[model samples]
Target: MLILECPYCGVAADETELSPGGEAHLVRQGPGSSDQELESYLFGRKNPKGVHFERWRHSYGCGKWFHAARCTMTLEVFATYSAQTPVPPKNVINAIKAKRPDWEGWT
Candidate 1:
């Protein structure tokens, strides 16, 4: 089973103890946005094949949300970080690069 570390609570939680919160770092469309923009925000997802970032909540532990950088094909977790930011931090990016030398980068 997959294991994820919760940054907030410092707990290494098993996959069964967590809940997937979908792709992370998505920009939310608000009131002044067009219908298409709002629609895309509501449903559109890149769903890429390689390196991906996602949100994971420690459902059975601290009940906090965190971000995880992982490989979609291999299901290899590179790193996990706090969910308060809009983008992956530099350390997380570096960790991914160390693990995956061919990574094209994420932004």
Candidate 2:
């Protein structure tokens, strides 16, 4: 099992307590695209190796959403933080921040 540090909850938590959102949003290198194209680009994913930052929900813990970085090969959790937390390494912070969806208007 992996110990995931939740941004809202703090401390480490069992992997089972969190729901993994595979592969956080990737930046669009090229410009000039419609919403449908952008949505398709942003929503796409690739199960790659090495360190990958992903969104995770602490469903059983804080019940809030957050992010985590882990190794695809070993499943080793290297880092984690909430959406409100300060920036982290590997361009993840900015990536997640840029891709933050408008959840408030969802309902």
Query: Each candidate: what lDDT?
Result: 0.92, 0.65
lDDT for position 82 in model 1? 95
**Model 1 agreement with the true structure over 8-51: per-residue lDDT tens digits:** 98888999999999999999999999999999999999798989
Worst 10 residues of 2 by lDDT: 98-107
Candidate 2's TM-score reads 0.63
**TM-score to true structure, per model:** 0.92, 0.63
Name the best candidate (by lDDT): 1
User: Could you give candidate 2's per-residue lDDT for residues 22-44 as a string of tens digits?
Assistant: 65545563478877778767776
> What C-alpha lDDT, on a 0 to 100 scale, does residue 94 get in candidate 2?
48
Error of 1 at 95 (Å): 1.0
Off by over 4 Å in 1: none
Most TM-score-accurate candidate:
1
Worst-scoring 10-residue span by lDDT in model 1? 1-10
